[model samples]
Target chain A: MLTFVVFSVRRAWQGFWRNSLMSLAATATMILMLLLLAGFWIIQTGLNAGLQFIEQKVEVVADLNDNAPADQLLQVETTLRGMPQVASVTFVSKDQALQDFRARLKARGQEDLTGYLDTNPLPNTLEIKLKNPQDYGNVVDYLDGQPTVVSQVTPIQNLVNQVVTVTNFLRTVGVVVLILVGLTVLFIIVNTIRLAVFARAEEIEIMRLVGASDAFIRWPFIFEGAMVGLFGALITLVVLAVVATPLQEFMYGFFRVLPLQFGTLVVRDLTLLVVGAGVGLGVLGSYVSVRSYLIR
Target chain B: MAPGSSTGLLRHPTLAGDRPPETTSERLVLALRDVAKTYPNGRAALRDVNLTVPEGDFVFLVGPSGAGKTTLIKLLIRDELATAGQVLLDGQDLGRLPRRQVPRVRRKVGIVFQDYKLLPRKSVWENVAFALEVTGTPGRRIGPAVDRVLRLVGLAAQARQLPTQLSGGEQQRTAIARALVHDPRLIIADEPTGNLDPLISWEIIQLLLRINEMGTTVLMATHNAEVVTALRKRVVGLEDGRVVRDEVGGAYHRED
Candidate 1:
């Protein structure tokens, strides 16, 4: 087994170097496939982060009736929390709400709201977090159906609906793009290997004549294809890292104008993105290339 | 579904004294029963040809242009299966076996083509050793096996050279070395020395005859009349796919 692996790898190495330009072309296809995938994943990650932030912080603030008692407010909290999709619940009392308003205004360098108002008009409410981004619409529907308390769930669900629609649409587009790019990679690699095989169809035919088992004949080619993938991934990762250096620095400088996560965290996440994308693309290309040869 | 289609396992036990080969009964190594091969575009390459090569024998398949000699060789090796009739190897029907099963049967046979078919990037050693390595031989055994075949084909000195750097004769010798490496019971040479001059051609034929003398059956398909007339070996003639003659102790010179 060890000998077989060694021979297989050696054949692959020789075959790879024999057609260096063709191998490079196949590798470039892999890199392009990976780059597209990585770019999509990064966008998806960013979009996911932004969506979750809004989901967690945004909620409907339903005011209670003038005659309503504290028990009724607790009942509303209990109902909202009982739903399976509700991730979390936080009830803000009127007094605590006033204190928060004052603190936020002072932080924003604004006048105190308590001094201008005769009473605490801010309604006590529960901030609801849906189980998933997909469930946000259902959460809005459930919250709007409550009428025992006074009407109106806060934070205007229309804009939230629009955001959900846009993000979902983009997610769908991302999936389609991923599949098309994957197939393009597959087609390119398969054709490259096929043309390589065609160039030596006589040798391949002779190999078949000399009692070479299909796997035996296929091993070297598959090994070559996979090594092509690995090499392509390595080169692509290098290119991505080079390109990202300036981009990351620019992002760090620009995002510094606002309070956000550290550049260090971005680097860590992007590293995962690069490696995952590269390996995935390489494996995909290798698989399609060998599959076509094996079928013949 | 031809008559007498054999599908038994080739269960010959690896008996002692089998290495250097020995004389056996006039056992037919390969039999083509009215085999016909017609291309899809309606070119008749072989037509109802009946030819049998016995074990331990050396036979030259001789014919003129459009004689279907190469096609016959291809059919025998399963490179191109016969379109109509059954091709039997050691009584196993070649047509019945699956494509995957063809290799093991092929292992019993070795073939050297006119084109040399050496992987251009592979060194001569690698070109020959590739045949052995793929058949799952142990690593330690490969060195001696390769060396023995190279010595037999007189390619031992040129083993390290790439196929591209070798002369036409040297490349053909390397191919012969590769065919001999596995010690297959049968070897097919289809116009192997077609591109070589008379001297080199004679040299290759002599080496093949020596291999045959050691009891490996050889089927060499060629159009070289000088080789046939000079060697006076068994000859099977094909014309438009039909076997015109199968004569023992035959020569190539004949009236038009």
Candidate 2:
């Protein structure tokens, strides 16, 4: 068994360099396909991050009555914070709301109509953030039940529903596109490796005639396929690194307002994804291609 | 030159003097009983073909092209299944051998092709050793086995040359060396001298005769009437997929 493995590895190394043209062609195709897959995967990751940011923006604002007691408001805020669906609940006093209104008016160059009023009629509120956007309705209903402390819950249910619908559609489309691209890469890579195997049909035939076990003939090609995959992945990573350096500023500028996660986390996932797919597909492709020759 | 004058051909270390090679006197090297083969396209390649080659016998298979010569060889190598009967190699039924056991059984029979199926990229030594290498023979064992066979076939000096660098006879000799590396009980030569000049063809025929004299059974399929007639060996003639004649000390054609 040890001899077999050593022989297979040595043969694989020789076979790869012996047919350098075909091997190089296979590696080039593998690199191109991996790059395309990695590009799509990075885009998909960014899409997910942006959608998560959008979902977190779905908050429930509950306005308290002007005459409500401070203790009742505090109790309501504590209860909202304790709910499993609520990520956090912050108390906003009437003074802060009025101040925010004045700031927005000043920024927009509108007249300070709010300051002209003799008394501040703005209501104090509790802004509730949910762990998941889909739990918006449950939190709104819970806040509405607190009629004594909560005067009226802002009916942003329609806005939340619209946002959820758009975000869900985009997420589904993103996943579907990723799957389609994955299948395309699989077919193209497998076929390209098949062509490489086909070029050596005579060698395989001679091996078979010489009473070579299927494993003896098969494992060498599998190792060769793996070599192609390894080389392709390394080349892809180098190209991605070179390109990422120049594209960093452009990507940061475009995603500044979107709050997408783009750092070491994304880079790590992309590396694993590209390398894993490159090697896995290479082995699978060779296995499938060489199967027909060995069956008889 | 007459094959008998080939002085050193049969005198090598791995040749005639080497313990009279392990042939079981009572056992048959190959046995076919009522074997019939019809391809998927409904062409009947062989019908009611029954042949038995006992230990240490040399047989000649002669026929026109498409007379089931190739199909017969294919069945012997287990490359194709007999659509009807059994092909027994060394008392084991080929039809019933498990898929994984096919290679083991193939190693018992060494085969040579007319085209000399040598890898162009590999040297003569590598080509011969390839048979043993792919069979998972130990590296230490492969080197001597290959060396012995190359010396037996008189190609040891050209062992480093590639197939393209050698003549047709030299390439065929390399192939025969590869076939012999496994020390197979049966050596099947399928028109092995088809591409050679008559003089070179005689050289290959003499080499096969020498191997046969050393206790290996040889089944040669050929269209060479002159060599076949001159040898007067056991002849099995196939016509329209049927064995029309089987005779010992027979000429290539009927005496009439």
Candidate 3:
């Protein structure tokens, strides 16, 4: 068993270098296809993250009557916190609301005309965040039911429905596009490796004639294919590493308002995907190509 | 049993009724009985072909192109199964052999092509060693086996040269050495001398005769009628996918 593996690996190494041009061509194709797959994967991940960020922004805010008792405000806060659908609830006093209004106006370069008012007209507000944007309907209904404590709840149900519809469509489209790209990468990489194997048909014929077993004839080519894949994957990872910082900067700049970050988990997953696909497709392609010669 | 053992001998006193019986030491290396091969495209490449070769015999397969010579060779190596009957190599029915057992059977029969298929990048020594290497011979055994075959084919001095550096005769000898490396019971040479000059052709024929004398059977497919007629050995002639003639001390053509 050890002899077989050593022989196969040695032959595979020799085969790769002996046909350097064909081997390099196969590796080049693998790199390009893997890069395409990784690009689509990154885009898909970013789209998902951006969509969740948008969904998290779907919160229901209710304006409280100035005459509502302090105890009633506390009760509303406790009730919102106890609800399973609500993620969190925060209470803003009228003074704090006025201060926020003034700060926004000043930051927008508009004059602080609120300072000229005789009294603070802003109302205390209860801000409620939901676990899911789709669950906003239940929270809005509950807030609207508090007639004595609440002056008015923001009419955001239509806006939330629209956002959900658009996000779902985009998510579906992103997934479909990623799948199509993944399949394309598979075929292109497999075909490239097939071409490399086809170039060595004479070697396979000689091996078969010399009474080499099916494993003997097959494993060398498989090892060669794997070498191509490993080389291609390593090169691709280097290219990714070189461009990673720039790529992340470009993504952040492009989607300035979207919360997109390439966390360590994403990096690890991407590395695994590239390496796994490269090696898997390489083995699969060689197996399929060599099969035609062996079966005869 | 050892490959050349007399225990494996198949007495054909009844099988070949007209022919006189040979010494009891001779064993059958190859046999075909009513073997017919029809390819997928409805081409009948061979039909009703019956031939038998005993151990250590040198036979010439002579025929015109497209006369089932190639198909006959293909059948011996189990490259294609006979459609109608059996092809037995060394008393083993090739058609009944399992897929995994095919390689084991092939090692018993060494094959040589007209083109001398040697890997261009490898040296002559590596070319001969390749046969044993791919067959999983032990590393230490490979060197001596390869050296012995190279010495047998008289190419031991040119062991380090590539195929391109060798002459046509040398390349053919290299192929023969590779075929001999396995110490096969039978060696099938398909037009091995087709590419060489007349003098070099005789040299190859002499080498084959020497190998046959050393207790290895040789079956050569050839178009060289001059050598075929002069050798006066057993000749099996094929015409339009059927064996037209099979005779001992036969010439290239029918004497009567």
Candidate 4:
């Protein structure tokens, strides 16, 4: 059995190397397919990360009445804590709010917020963080349902809605592109291996006549395809690590002015791609082509 | 039992007519009964052809182009099924055998073709060993088996040479050697000497003869009349997909 395996592998290697052009073409297709798949995966991962960051910061603000009693404010905090959707609620007093404003102003070298308002009139605020970004509306509804707090304003509501809509849209686009890229990769490798098989149809026929079992004949070509795919995936990973992340980060910085690391994202994604879809797809493509020929 | 074993030989003289047949009993090695075929394009490739080949018999089936010689050979090997009638080997119909069992049938009947389809990339020794290796021959057994067959075909010296590097005659002999590696009971050669010179053809025919003498049944389909007449073996002639003549110890057909 060991000898048979050795012979089977040796024959496949001999056939692959004997026709260098076909072998090279198969390798090239596998690499191209893997690169595209990994690139798509990396883009999807980075976009998902950015969207998750936005989702994490999405929350509701509660505006307290100017003359509301301190004990009543404590009642509202307790009310928020009882709701399942409300994860936590923090009270920001009027004085504390003013202090926060002054700290922001100090960063701009203009820490003089007390001189503008004669009565020191910033409202007491309630900052409500929810268990889910999508449940922000539920928190707003629960708080707004109260008779006394009906007039309270949430300035972050519009921004939250816009972020949710845009993230959902971008996710849909990402899924569509992922599917398209996957199909394109599959087509490229399948046709490439099929062409390789066609070129060696006579060899296949001779092998069939010689009583080489279907598996014995098939495994080597499949192995070759896997090798080609592995090589292609490696090339794509290198290119992704060196190119896509930096480009994505540059684009993100242009859009949001946030500090983004293109290199780190690419490195992380490339590792996943080279190991997962790279090896998987290489074997898959070869198996499909080799089985098709074996039937004939 | 071994040929003429003590179990049979001891009791045979007393039994007389009731004794079992000899080791050389004339059992049918291959039988094609009323086998006919028509291509999808409506061309009748073979029609109502009947042939019976006995064990240890070297029978040549001769015909001109389009006379269905190759088609008949294909039917025996189960490469092509007949459109009408049936083919049998040892009373087992070729049509009834599933493809999985076809390899076993092929193992019993070896074929050597005219074009010499040895793998160009493989060495001559690997080419012959390819047959035994497919039949699940162990690694140690393959080397000796391949060497023995290569010696029989006079190719032991060039065993390490690639088919592309060898002469046409040598390549054909390597193919023959590969065919014979498994010691099949029936050897079918379809125009085995078609591409060779007279001297080379004579050498191959002599090898075939020697193998036949060693008790293998040989069915050679050929176009060479001179070789056929010289051999003076049993001949079955085909004309337009039908059998025209069957002669024992016969020569080739003549215009006169």
Q: Top model by TM-score, which number?
A: 3
**Which segments of candidate 2 are over 4 A away from where they belong?**
A2-29, A43-58, A62-89, A92-125, A129-167, A243-268, A292-296, B1-25
Q: Model 3, stretches more than 4 Å misplaced? A: A1-29, A43-59, A63-133, A142-171, A179-187, A246-264, A292-294, B1-26
Give lDDT tens digits, candidate 4, residues A65-159.
77666676677778889988888888777899888888866764655858767776777778887777556766787678764642485736466
lDDT of 4 at B238: 80
Show the lowest summed lDDT stretch of 10 residues, model 3 chain B.
B8-17
Pairs that collide in candidate 4 are A31-A232
Kindly list the per-residue Cα lDDT of model 4 for residues B111-190, writing each as its tens digit: 88999888787899988887777666788898988999999989999999999999888998898888888788889999
lDDT of 3 at B32: 84
TM-scores of the candidates in the order shown: 0.74, 0.77, 0.79, 0.77
Residue A43 Cα positional deviation in candidate 2, in Å, after optimal superposition: 4.8
Query: Candidate 1 docking category?
Result: medium
Tens-digit lDDT string for candidate 1 (B47-149): 7666666788788888897889877777777777788988899778998989878889888888898888898878999888878877778888989999999
TM-score: which is higher, 2 or 3?
A: 3
Better lDDT candidate (2, 4):
2
Cα lDDT of model 3 by residue, A1-296, tens digit: 77789999997887788778877877887888778778877876776676566556537779999899879878988998999998888888889989988886776567988878998998888877777755777788888888889989974545556656766786677668655754555565456556656666777789889899989988987887788888888899999989989998899777654656668898899899999988887777677766765576
Ordered list by DockQ, greatest first: 3, 2, 1, 4
Which number leads on DockQ? 3
Alpha-carbon deviation at A179 in model 1, angstroms: 3.5
Score each candidate by Cα lDDT.
0.73, 0.81, 0.82, 0.74
Model 1 per-residue lDDT tens digits across residues A1-296: 78778877886787777777877887787778777766666555555555555555645545555455668667777887888877777766677888888897787576775887888887666666566645566666666766666456655355557767877898899889878876776666666666656665666676776787777667777677777667766776677677776755564454332233325776576666656665565445555666666564
